[model samples]
Every structure is written in C-alpha cells, then in structure tokens.
Target: MKALSESHYWATNKKKSKETDQLSPFKVLVRKEVSDHVHSWRFILLLALVLLTFFASLYISMSNIRASFSNVNDPDHAFLYLKLLSATDGSMPPFHILMSFLAPLLGITMGFDAINSEQNSGSLTRLLAQPVYRDNILLAKFYSAMLIIATLFISLTLLMIGGGLFFTGVRIESQEFLRIIGFSVLTIVYVGFYLSLSIMLSVAFRHASTSALTALGIWLFFTVFYPILVNLAIRAFLPDAAYLTQGEKLAYNELIMDIMRVAPGQLYSDGATTMLMPSIRSLGPMSMEQLSGAIPSPLPLRESLIIVWPQLTGLLAGSIAFFALSYYLFMRREIRS
Candidate 1:
C-alpha cells in the first residue's frame, strides 16, 4: 500500500508540472488581449475617429502654415515644426489639443471592462485556471493596451513629419525633430495615466458601464471645467482681492497655478504650450522684477526639457501609482467567477 501511494503522488506532481509548463504564459495572455482589442468594434470606431480628426486638423494646419510662411519673421520660426502640428485656421483647436481630448476615450474603451467583462461572461474563472501565473492576466492587459497606444502615437508622429516635409518642401531640422519626439513621448505618458486609471476602476467596480462612465466623468472634469471651477473657487476664497497690490496679485496667481497643476490635463497643456511656443519662459506669472532684462527669445531643447521635467515626472508618477493600486486591489480581490 505504501509503495502504491508513493507512485501515485509522484505521478500527480509530474502532471501538474507539465500543465504549468505547457506554453509561454506571458505571450499567451498578451496575444489574447491584443487579438480581442484588434477585433473589437469599439477599437475600430475609435481608430476611425482619431484618424479622421487628426488628418483633417493636419490639412487645416498645413494650409495655415503655407499662408504664413512668407510672413515668417521670428528669426527662427523656432516654432516652425510646432506650428505645422498645431496652427489652425482659427476655426478649430489644434491637432494636438484634439488628440488630448480623444486619447482618453481610447484608454477608457480599452480598459473599463478589463476584468469585469471576463467575470460576467464566466471566463474569468477559466482564465485563472490556465497554466499562466495569475498576475500575467492583469499585466498582459496593460502591456497590450500600452503597445496599441504607442504604435498609434508613433504612426501619427511619422505622418505629421511626412506631411510637413511634403507640404512645405523643407527638411525638418534636427532640433525640431527631437522636440517633436519629446512631445509625442509626453503625450503617450499622459494618455497612459488615463489607461491605468480606467483599469483601476474596472478592478474596483463590478460593472464595466459603471467604470466607463466614472472614467469619462473624471476626464471631462479635468479637460473641460476643472480649471474654471478652480478659478471660481479661488475667487470665492479671495473675493476682496481685486484691489490687492501687484505683489499680492502675483502671489495669488501663483497659488492658483500650483492648484491647477493637480489636474493632469493642466500639467500636460502647460508643458506642451511651453515646448511648442519656445517664447514661453515662465510657467508661473512673472512680475517685471522676475523678468528683468529677459529677452524675448526661443528656448533651446535642454532648457525646454528642464522647464517641463516636473510635469513629466508628475505624469509618470500618476501612471505608476494607478497601476500599482490596481495590482494591489487585484491581488486582494475575490475571484468569484
């Protein structure tokens, strides 16, 4: 009896080992997530919308740039590349602003149902039973969505550069190219924060719709009304400050600026504005004392980076914090499906 039991135990252990080693678990999970996103109707529609808006904005901007190329007198037109990407016909926002608004939709759509949909369909239980480690499922979803966003950003960057060259008949300068690259990278980081935020929502809520609406609510608040609300609240607190001295006024403005930076959109827009409009030096309100003898000149790439590094750091921190929170919550979540 002892000999028979020993043989059976070894056989069961070997079978389990084989099951766990059947395939590359991470790749399997990533492939599954990528395939689902690629084939989904929502992704298709979202891609169509992004492309339509971007190319239309690009066309409008190119026309404006051509019309003004003859009048260019900024010594450097230091903003030639940025102008190509952002200068509109005064009828619409720039291409980059349109992108900023549209990108959160991509994040919310891809991530809002990450876990709950699987649970609803009764597939979550089966996925957990697979040979892959449990954490691979969550990581795979994030990495797959990140990969899609990165590819989209890169393609758009190339399209912008190509369009600029073809329309203007001039090669992009090395410095301009680097600045554009930096802008694209920062935009990705900004969008990634939303992606991670939506994923955390999915992990927290049991219903995908709930998570999606919540994510969209947060997005709209930041993009549309957050600053207005902040300004109003500041005034409410300082209702009698309209007659304040110049120094007091400057201090009040600085206080509001710091508060506005709490929103990711504000940080990104401020940073992008500075990088694109090289003439912008101070993010905060500057009195003459602060700007004494400051010439109106375009900043170098290094200087722009130094100015925006804090914003970049904030974006990176937000992305990592949201993802870490999601992971922690997932580890503690009960697998009921």
Candidate 2:
C-alpha cells in the first residue's frame, strides 16, 4: 500500500508538470519570433543605425534649442519641450524628420523576411506541421514585430523626455508630454504601415531579396520620386496663369496638398509636425475669413489631434489593409516540406 501511494503521488506530479508545459501554440510562436528578432544581427545593425540618427538629430536640436528661447516675446516660451524635438541648427534635420526617413527602414528590416526566410529554410513547413494554426503563424510574426516596434518607440520617447529634462533643465508640461506621446505613436503607425507592406511582399514573393528590394523601391518612390510626380501633377492640373481668382488659387493649393498627402510619408510628416508644433493651426489652406480672426497661440493637445485625425486614420487604415491582404495571400498559399 505504501509503494502504491508513492507511485500515485509521482504520477500526479508528472501530470501537473505536463499541464504547465502545455503552452498555447500561438504563445510559443510569438515567443519564438520575438526571440529570433531580438537575437538577429541584422536587427541589431538596423537598431544601431536608428539610434545613431536619433542621437545626432537630438544633439543638433538641443545645441540650437536656446535660439528658440532667446526671444522674450516669442510664442515658443510655452513649448520648450516641443521645440527640443523640432528645433535645428540648420546643419541637420530635426529628430522627427530624421525619424520619418529611418522609421520605415526599421519596420521593413523586421518584416521583409518574416515568412520567406522560414519558408526557404524549410522550417515553415515543419512549424505548420505542429499543432499551430495557419492564422497563428502570420499573426505571430506581425504581433511580434509590432511588439518590438512599440517597445522601441516607447523607449525612445522616454529617452527623449529624459534627455530633454537632463540637458535643457526644463520640466515638460503635461500637454507637451502628451504631444510627444502622440508623435511617438504616429511614428509607430507610420512604421507599422511599412511593416505590413513588407510582410505582404514577403508573403507574395518567394525570395527574401525580391521582397527587400521591392520594399526599398516603394520607400524611394514615396519618399523621393512621388513628391516630384505630385508637383508635376499640380503644375499640369493648375497652370500658372495671372488671371486665376483667389478662390481658384486656394482650391488649387488644397488640391495639391490632397495629392501630396496621398503618400504615407506626407501623412506621417503632416501628423508629426502637427503633434510636435502646436502653433500649426491648419494642415490645409485657410480662407481669409478663417484666418482673419484666428490667434497664433499654441493649440491644446486635443485640438492638435483633431487637426491630424485624417492623417492618423489614413495611416492606421493603410496598415490594416496591407496586413489583411498579406493574411489573405498567406492563408491561400500552399506549403510543402
């Protein structure tokens, strides 16, 4: 009886251990993906580049920040922290601008090979053969990448706040802090759009190089060539004529801005500028009546968000659409060992 009772106790302990070890397949996939990304050398290199760019811009912004505070009557007095991010010595761009260019690269780097690399290595087949659902694989990769991105931008935001406090000795106001948070979130959304796009390319293309090059091409077109194309379109649409009325000119300007904002980079820049520069009242051309009575005071955080709602919505929607398309493509594709 004593031996039987001891055996039963050991069996119960073994059952408990098995229960503890039975983690959800989704959780396991997410953990594995996160671990892989955190350990990868390419991710480390890209992270270093982003940090270098951020600190260089921050140094330039901080060094010249005093100029913004020099004028006694300057409206910038109420926004010293905001100025820390936007102010520049003209030798380099501000933090937000540099981030606008670099954030997409980080996103693309994390996701461009998310699936194809696994597929090529034959691990994807083995992974799918486990108890994991098809949806779990794609969702795991996306969520893991997003988790890393969110962690990165949040860390940067905290660092910016701390660095500003340390160097400038200026206490950040509540609204300023909120605006900085909004800017960081906007940047994450911008990066997320690229991440989704890169993931979609990875799903559609078999080779990782093809997906990487395609993502870079899209980035270049949107960042560099798209604006040029928009300018040419504006010129074609609204020719330079002396007889154009005020209303017509305003309409033309609005149309051109709408065309320009179609690019994700423009959306991000417009939103980040609005969040970081509270003095910017409108993103589009203002009529005489609308501008005549408006004061130049810095807007509250709520108003700034209202001004950038369209941009924020567009970016989020684009991210969702791209991820949805990628999910669809990945679900339908066949895999073999």
Candidate 3:
C-alpha cells in the first residue's frame, strides 16, 4: 500500500511538471530564437544592408531637396518646402521599396534551413527527444523571424523619419506620423507573409538550398515578373476594354481593381496612395462633389475609417490568410528524413 501511494505521488508530480512544460513552450521557444538570432551572421549582414540602403536613399532625397531650394526664386519658398515635405508622402520611401524586395530574401534565408539544418546536424532528433513539441519548434521559429523582421522594419522607419526631419527641416504632422507607423506595420505584415511561406518551404524541402531557391523564384514571380505578366494578361484579354466610355470603363476598371487586390503589395500600394494623398478625393464611380456629399460635412476619423475600411481589411485579411496557410502546412509536415 505504501509503495503504491508513493508511485501515485510520483506520477502526479511528473504529470504536473509535464503540464507546466507544455504551457510555457512559446516562451521557451522565443528565448531560444532570440538567442539564435543574436548570434547569426545573417542577422548582422541584413541589418547592415538595410541601414546602408536607408542612408543612401535619404542622401539622394536630401540632395534633390537642396537643389530645388537653391533653384528657388524666393529666399523663403514656402511652396518648395511644402513639396519637399510631401516628397515622402503618398508612396513608400525608395529605400522601403528596396527593403520590401529584400525582405523576402532575408526571410527565406533565415527560415529555409530552420528544420533541415537541425535535421542534418541531428539536433532535431535530440530536441524532439526532449519534452518539446514539434509544433512548438515551428511556432518558435516563425515568431523569432517575425520579431526580427519587425525590428528591422521599425529601425528603418525611424531612420527615414529622422532623416526626413534632419535634411528637410520639417516637423512631421501627427497624421503624417501616424501614416508612417501604419506603413511600417503594413511592411511588417508583408514580410510576415513571406516569412511564414519560407517556414513552410523549409519544412517541405529537405535541402535548405532548394527551399531558398523555391522562395526566391516565388518572390521574383510575385514582385518583379508577376506585375508584367498581369499587365500583359490584362491587355491581351481586354484590348478594347481600356477604350470604353468613361462610365462603363469606370465600372470595368473597378471590377479589375477588386480582382487585382488579391496581390497584397499592389493592394497596399493602392490603399496607401489613396490614404496619404489628400488630393485624391475621388476613386472610381464617384465624383469629388459626390464623395464629399456622401460623407459628413467635416469628415471625422471614424468616417475616414469607414471609407478606407474595405481596403484596410482586404490587405490585412489577405496577409493573415497567407500566413495561416503557411503555418498549417508547416505544422503538418513530417520532420523525419
């Protein structure tokens, strides 16, 4: 009876310990990921590259602004300053464009070997042999990549804002500041999508190089070649559609635009332009007067949200869906060689 009681107590304690371990998996994973990232040469190189690109872009923009000021007729050219201030408006920074192109490559580079490298080194078996769950490992890797990518984006954003203020001598308005933050968040979401895809590919492919190559191919297809292909496809299929009457063309164009919003980058670009540019009061089937009349006399924040809500939701939803799909595929993948 005594021995049985002892055994029961031990079993209870063991189960309690296991439960505790399972409950804290994410924290453990995050810690390990943070540690690994700190030691990675890739992380350092990526940071350096991003910083370099950002500074270079800032210099170019400043140089142009200075030239414009020098060529000004009035010593106090308020209009020239306003134009300089608005330079960073509407679209993303040029450096951000470069970063977006580079972000996937960095994500793929970081994630392509996540599982395969461990498997190759025989660390995966040993790690799995411990109390850790397979799903935890995948989640940890993803979270780590996201954390790192987000940090990089934040750093780039601060750099741009600082550079803009320093070179242009313009104080960023509250709205403009908020817009920059929104742009950064959008960028992080975009990078997150690619990171999750990379994680999925890492799990799917045995060779890290194969995963990287596949990711690069997809990135090129989506970013560089896809737009060209889309344009060609649109032109080929709708040759006469572009020449239609204004009202009919607007309806057709709206339909096409809705379909094209499937691509997050394009969607982001369109939505961002519309939001940042105060001059763009009308978009599709609505005249400026009609749009102004549709809203409250003085548009409040909520009203503005209501107007762009569809676009904001669409871009965010698409990003979430892509990441979710990647996560599902990654979790289901077998780690065995």
Better of 2 and 3 by lDDT: 2
Candidate 1 Cα lDDT to native: 0.85
Candidate 2: where are CA atoms >4 Å away? Answer: 1-19
Which of the two candidates, 1 or 2, achieves a greater TM-score against the reference?
2
For residues 2-58, could you state the per-residue lDDT of candidate 2 as single tens digits? 999999999999999998788788888899999999999999999998888888878
Q: In candidate 1, which residue pairs clash?
A: none
Off by over 4 Å in 3: 1-23, 66-93, 163-170, 239-243, 274-278, 282-312
Which of candidates 1 and 2 reaches a greater lDDT? 2
What are the lDDT figures for the candidates, one per model?
Answer: 0.85, 0.90, 0.66
Q: What is the TM-score of each candidate against the true structure?
A: 0.89, 0.93, 0.74
| Clash number by candidate, in order | 0, 0, 0
lDDT of 3 by residue, 204-298 (tens): 77888888889888877777777787678778877496468767677767777766666656655654444443334434455344556453222
**lDDT tens digits, residues 1-337, model 1?**
9999999999999999998777588987888899999999999999999989988888887877866555555533545678877677888898778777887788889999998889889899898887766678889999999998889888998989988877777888887888888888888888899999999999999999999999999999988799889978986788477689989988888888999999988888877776677777779998988799977788888998999999999999999999999999998988875
* Model 1 TM: 0.89
Clash pairs, candidate 3, are none
